[model samples]
Target: MIVRVFGFSVIVSLSALAVAFLYRGWTGLALCAILGILEVSLSFDNAVINATVLERMSRFWQQMFLTVGIVIAVFGMRLLFPLAIVWITGGLAPVEAFRLAMNPPPDGADHFADGRPSYEAILLAAHPQIAAFGGMFLLLLFLNFVLGNRGLTWLSWIERPLGQLGRLDQLAVVIALVILVVAAEYLTPDSTRATVLISGILGAVTYLLVDGLSSLFQRRQPGGPDTSSVPGPPDGDCADRTDMQHGEIRSGEPARARHRPAPIAAAVGKAGFFLFLYLEVLDASFSFDGVIGAFAITPDPILIALGLGFIGAIFVRSITIYLVRQGTLGQYRYLEHGAHWAIGALAVILLVSIRVEINEVVTGLIGVAFIGASLASSVRANRRDGRHAHHEAVRTH
Candidate 1:
């Protein structure tokens, strides 16, 4: 499974290295390698979150994530998205934007020979909107997880109370908006406040629309949204343990429904489309920080896309599948919780970064810390459960 998943990453890495070397010799290759590593470090939590969503998707959609989805992620978000932003905001034609990106003027030096702003300058100027949009989107994702009513609690002290608050409708939305407003009005520069606010509002609205559509499609499913299939801690508390075990798909749906594979397949196809859309948007949100941060290393759009977009994106998708295949979420139940916690922190960091720059290394460290702690905790829990089961068996005998 490891080879099956990561073989592509290896190939992509080699290809990126070669492309970089050919483009500008060893220095370019070195930059590409660094960017690739940076992307992987930054996006590890993204892989975890993707796993949570992908686990619930159909096999066909899962395949799409590997195939067509990678293409969209690499080219669409990494390449075209930045160019489009430059085109729209800088009032440059797409071709002109691409040219500027490919051949940016040196820092404090003019290569364009024209007074036009370089790609990096324009992109950096648009940082407020990018930060606002990505931060709010991620903030909502984190709130939805904590504010959800799932019975299991890794951080029982805090999560239990938050889960209680889940009884209130639109709690996540309200909190997200409040944060957005605070960031825009108080945290951001006055000149960019309006842009930040609008972008943040749009981010929150986009989340609502996508989540609502996903829920709507889920309900339209033959069996409806199988809450059991949600990829986190089991649905019920430790006491009322009657629910399906983690990772078990409910099996009691009508066999006749199964027999009519065509309609059922059609329904699944429709459902998967929305889920796929959600995944892509989620991917975009995850990449926004990395994309913005990549400018710190090199503003060469081609290099960013080659290394971060292709190599890093492929590896993340592979890791998502690997986690699912290993049943890591079920095995280490707190992993998903930890990933969401990291996401929450990242969201805050992204927002704060609008005012003050935060190092990408710091962001990566926070996520790895959370996930690492969760893995250690999971190991201890497994040992404890094993011992308890052994004790119970001996007592019964």
Candidate 2:
């Protein structure tokens, strides 16, 4: 079963390595492999967060994420997105940006003589805006999870209080804005302060637009409150409740497939389309970190696409699908919560990184630590429950 789920990722990773080796020999192959590993490590939490959303999507959309989504992940974010940034910030044409990326000038090269900042320089200069955008988007996501009036919490002391306050709509937005202000004033350079603020505002707006569109597309049943409005709690255990209708086929008893809960069916039509858009935007936001981080390894666009884009993204998609199919979220009830917490930490890190250079290794380690801790908690909870169940059986006997 594990082989079936991850077979494609394995193939693609190996293929990327082979191609990299052919293109630039052992050095290229090693860099690509390292970048691939870095991407996966930095984004494991991304996979967990993605599974929470992907499981709600229909099978068709799930397939779409694996298919069309992979193209966007690789070519769009990995390849073109950097060029687009260069075009926007440097006023360089796409062809010129592509040229610069392919043949980046040495650091401190004269712009007039060379006709542009080195790709690395331009990318570094653009970090303020990138950080503002991606950080705000992720910050909103974390705030929503923390502030939502959901009862479930992995870290009860902190999350429980925050969850209670979540009933106040727009509280998250307020907090996000305050954080942005602090980032702009204290963390961002004076020259880039306005850029960071504007980008962060736009990020917040983009998040709202996508979220609103998704809500608009959701299916509404007559006489029932809009289900989407009722925010799912921070506890990862809440699977879609729609599957409960099936019950047990043979025994007329409650069906408890590995103690998994039924998930709500994803909305189709316009709703599905917007949900798809939401997923893509979420992906872009996630990719911003990887794209920026990859520059520290090598400024070669093609290699970045091969390593982080092709290999890492394929694995993330596979992991998302595996989590959904295996009902892992339902089983490891705190995993989603842990992922969100990691996201919040990453958001802070991105914002801080605009001022201070942080090693990609450290960044990756932070995510892994959060996820590992969550998995440990999940296992402990399972054992505790097992003991209780055994005791109950003993009493009944």
Candidate 3:
């Protein structure tokens, strides 16, 4: 399974390394390699969140994301997107932007020749707006998930209350707006207040538009949303295993429904078109920090962008495939909970970073901590349930 999934990723990574060597010799190769590791470490939770969505997609769309999406990610987002930022913010012509990108300034230098802003300088200047948008979108995602009623959870104490409040209409939006206002008015600097506020609002609206369209598209499915096929602890079956354990039956649903394969709603069709858009937007948000942060290593825009795909992008895609293919969510029931919680933390960190510089390592560790704790909790629950099942079998025998 590992080889089948990661074989392509390995090939892509090697090719990228060779390109790096050819482009700038050993220095480019080393820097690109380090950036790859940095991206993977920082974006691990992104893979988990992405798997939750990808599992619902049909095979065609899933493969599309793996193939075509990689090209878009590498060239469109990694390469052209940064140049756009530099061009727009720094007021440079497209060709000039491309030229300046090729000749990046020295490390930590804000400007290059004639005191013009460097590509990195423009990106840093744009960070506040970037943070505002990505942070708000992610914050809303976390809120929407926790607000839904669910059977399995790692942090019941908090999640339970949020779930209870879910009945209120658009409660997540109300809360997000309030937080955004507070952050913009009080937290952000006076010079960038309007930009930050407007960006944050755009983020919230974008989430609503994309997510709402996805749900609307989902309803276009012939039989409605296929909620019954995923045989996990969700829907109140088992906290650690499939609900159909020991031939047990869930009332109101056929045994075959639980036994059916992963729910594939034809993502290549209308049912998944908007969902695909949502995933792309989510991927962009995940890469926002990494794209900006790569400057600390080297200012060469070409390497910074290509470096992401060298190893990081492919590995993330592969991990998402593994999780869905292996049904990791069903095996470790609280994984979804962990991933969402980590997203909430990351959202807050992104917002806070607008006022104060937060280390990327600190951001990564916080997410890992939340996921690790949830994994431990899930292990305990599984062990306890297994022992109970064994005792019940012994008595029956």
lDDT of each: 0.79, 0.80, 0.78
Error of 2 at 121 (Å): 0.5
Q: How accurate is candidate 3 locally (lDDT)?
A: 0.78
Estimate, for each residue in 1-397, the C-alpha lDDT of model 3 and write its tens digit. Answer: 9999999988888888889999999998998899888888877788988888888788888988898788777777788888888888888899998998887677557787688777777888899899999999999998888876665556888887887887687998999999999999888999999999999999999988888777777766775453322211223324213443334435434322333333334554776777778888888887877787787788887688768865888788999999989988667767777888889998998888888887788888988888888788777776776776677668779
Q: What is the alpha-carbon lDDT for the whole of candidate 2?
A: 0.80
lDDT tens digits, residues 238-335, model 2? Answer: 42233334342233222223235554556566666677778888889888878988988888888999999889999998988899889888788778
Candidate 1 lDDT over 1-397, as tens digits, reads 8888899889988988899999979989989899888898778899999987787677888999899999999999999999999999999989988988888776544335677777888988888899899899889989888887666667888998998897698888999999998888788888889999999999888887777676567657876444422323224542223223232223443221211111112225667777788889889988888888898888888899988887889889999999977877767757888999999999999899888888888999999999888778777776776676677668779
TM-score of each: 0.90, 0.90, 0.91
Model 3 alpha-carbon drift over 4 Å, by segment: 106-108, 226-268
Instruction: In candidate 1, list every pair of residues with a backbone clash.
Output: none
Candidate 1, poorest ten consecutive residues by summed lDDT: 255-264
TM-score, prediction 3:
0.91
Candidate 3's displacement at residue 329, Å, is 1.1
Candidate ordering by TM-score (highest first): 3, 2, 1
